[model samples]
Target: MAVCKGCGVTLQSTDPNAIGYTPKEGSEYCQRCFRLMHYDDLTVSMRTGIDPDQIIEQIAKMDALIIYVVDLFDFEAGMIPGLARKLPDKDILMVCAKRDILPDTLNHEKVARFVFARLKELNIKVKGLVLTSKLHSEGIDDVKEAIRMLGHGRPVVVMGRANSGKSTLLNNLFGQNILTSSRFPGTTLEMNQIVVDGITYIDTPGIEIENSLLMDVNESDLKTILPYKTIKPQIFQLHGDQSFAVAGLARLDLMECDHAACVWYLSDKLQVHRSKVQAADELWRKHYGELFSPVPLEENFRVSTIRKNLSKMDIVIDGLGWASVSGQISTISVRAPKSVNVTFRKAML
Candidate 1:
């Protein structure tokens, strides 16, 4: 039976609105899996189609080492902790995918450190980490070399967040189309395995969901979220403690800095406005639906009041981009969907 490319469920052409509905070609999944793939609720997102528990079960069955790919742009959001905790025995080589999209000014050390720290938080032990740009073929060979060094005759289980280039990486390694891919998220729904150079490459769908940055956005907004070309970093120089919001879905509090602290490296298409940390709420209310437009009024999340202060935190507005704040003995309240991550970093600009 062919699996649905959208939800990784077994396909059935019987029901048009059901999961895996593929007409005569037949869907690749059941009805439930399909709704979860395109739905708005968190419960839908936590379903088996993209759940870490399901992925962990599959990971446990693999005999070879594991290669966990992550999006450099949305690393925090794509992280899967439970999967790592479940696969205690498998050796993991974390691959930081999509290097071409990040701003050139991104601090490499900070980025690497963040990835390592985030992986550790997920309880994933790694032999090494490779920063890669699948579009540029930057570290694909290194990934291959790492697989070779593992010396596991079994297949290499390739894992990562949704649309993190897991399929494309395999396509490059095997020089064949073993797994289908798209520019949008939730593209690869099933677990695809391809053997290359005596190595089995396991492809799994993206697990984590930071839908706050994705949902409610149309095709035009998608361009702002996942840019194909190198994004021009938008830097904002702040005098002291200040706050910023992207499309009303995310907020940032730049804590105290002795120097003129600069918050740089976000999506060029994203609109960033700077003001007093306290005025952030007012600015958002005034400009969210008008100036800094991201989501539609009716479709946006019902976030009436922002949450309390989040101190020393790094908030990445999925797709649009992320910000690393420095120079502060302060905090700011925020609110959004539970799927998005509010983290802290030591400044990677």
Candidate 2:
């Protein structure tokens, strides 16, 4: 039941060289991940818990067929270039899982287009994209038919990011919830194959990478990260040197305001720093644990000093929120984990 952090494989007490291995009272990792961590250059040969590359290599050596499932909500981050790049010879059919939770405004065609664009960025060409919600059984037959037609009698592989609902979809395909479902992240931690009639499908573990970003954070943090329900957008007007903290996960230092020049778009539940930008530092020094509290500033989440000029470039705090500048401003700096991606964008506000 405990999942491996290194490769997301399930842990078992039986085989030390098996997919799941828990060392004596210490830690657990899939056998392949253990070898990757401990033994350099030694690779998984013929067992489960194989690394993504090994999985890709296996897929590459296959007889040309697959269905790549991607979490539509986090498609950009869940991309697997190793698999996509290696399986070019095989027919690649992309399946977008979790259609039920998408905001109503999200156009299905638009999502497919976005997936295509992201795949292109990864240098992986695809034949088509299918969107589905296995929970509701939508688009199931279409995906089945697509795979059946493209696979041309070869075994079909089902691979995707962890929690993308692959197991859920598979269970639905079998008309029951045979797979275990949980509210936590990274639940499915291994590649499993289930056969229906003649087609055999392979399920791979969700791999982590630079793009895992918000995916790598703890579930509690994600409660502050992914906005599940509607959040009323908050906007704050401030004076020079205004500072604000976002659920204690991030901070914003606002300088000379031409327009609003504020950090907007945080979780509706998080408190925005409303005091003068000048008092921002004093506020943190005085009340980080007291008033300006989000998910308390943990040692693990801490980052070095953040200092950068406002410089009119839009600052985006990944997961939580972002800010846009209007008028003259100096530098604004923030410090958070290196995992959090801070990117600049044109002002959308």
Candidate 3:
């Protein structure tokens, strides 16, 4: 059976409305990809063909070199638990995707070291880490060289959480646009295998994200959430009670603090609203969906609050990026939608 070159689904000419439908036999691309490529029209992405855990289980059972893809901007969202325990005795290569979106002045070695340090702190074992940007064709050769040296004639498996650019990297390696790449999650529904120089490269389905804001948002909101270009840290200095609303996604309150600086690492498209506590609340209540714009509209997100104390820490909100808060702030309050994971860890800068 011939699979669609764009989405890797079995091509069929029987149904005009179904997924992977082609005009006739010998068609290389599906109608869905055809419309998406030419008219920018998107279709409903499918799931449920295979469980994400089952795919991981199969990969663990096989003797392969795992190329674990991760988004550097949304690092916390990509860290799957028990990943090391599942793939025992297998060489894991950590590919940090979307490296071009980070500030250019930052030292590369320092960033790489930070990645290794963070992974070590999480107890995830990996042979080496490579920073890549599929958009700019960066780190492609280095990644191929790593695969060549580390694979040792074993098949390669690429896996990561949704929107981690798993398909984008595959297209980069294939030297053509074969896989369907999109900003939204659930783009790849099944595992796909492609041959490169007689070796197999497997593209597994992205791990579904439960607590992500994307899960509860509209498809059009992806442009505001996903960063496409380099992001400059928005710096703020605070002394007294101050609050910030991240486009109605989360409300961050630096309450009763002596002195501190909070650096937000988020998409340039999302605006950060900063003001005094009283004004912040008034504004949030009045202009959430309007002024705050791109607000979480689907789910009626309850205002869940979480408090954390830190000297220098990264305040993470699941799918969204984190904020590096530093100084004498004894307590911080995070008010966001319920089910969204709000936690802190040692600063990863």
Per residue, candidate 2 scores C-alpha lDDT tens digits across 98-202 of 665555566777766656666776887666778888556888888877876787877776666555666666766667644443323444455555567777766
lDDT by residue for model 3 (26-63), tens: 98888887876677666655522346688788888878
Q: Can you give the lDDT of residue 128 in candidate 3?
A: 86
- Candidate 1, 1-349: lDDT as tens digits: 7765434556777776544555556444444443434452222232224665576687788777888777777776667656655777788888887788777767668778877776666677889888888665888788878878984676788877776777777777776654555555665666765556666666787764545355445544666656677777666666666776766556565556444344545666667677787687788788876786775424434332332243333445555566654444344344444544454454444
At residue 186, give the lDDT of candidate 3. 69
What is the overall TM-score of model 1 with all chains considered together? Answer: 0.76
Task: Return whichever of 1 and 2 wins on TM-score.
Answer: 1
Off by over 4 Å in 2: 1-50, 81-84, 209-244, 252-277, 284-335, 343-349
Which run of 10 residues does model 3 get worst, by summed lDDT?
A: 299-308
Top-scoring candidate (TM-score): 3
Q: Point out where model 1 deviates above 4 Å.
A: 2-49, 105-110, 176-178, 196-198, 210-212, 215-220, 253-258, 277-279, 296-313, 317-320, 333-339
Give the TM-score (vs. native) of candidate 2: 0.64
Clashing pairs in 3: none
lDDT of each: 0.63, 0.59, 0.81
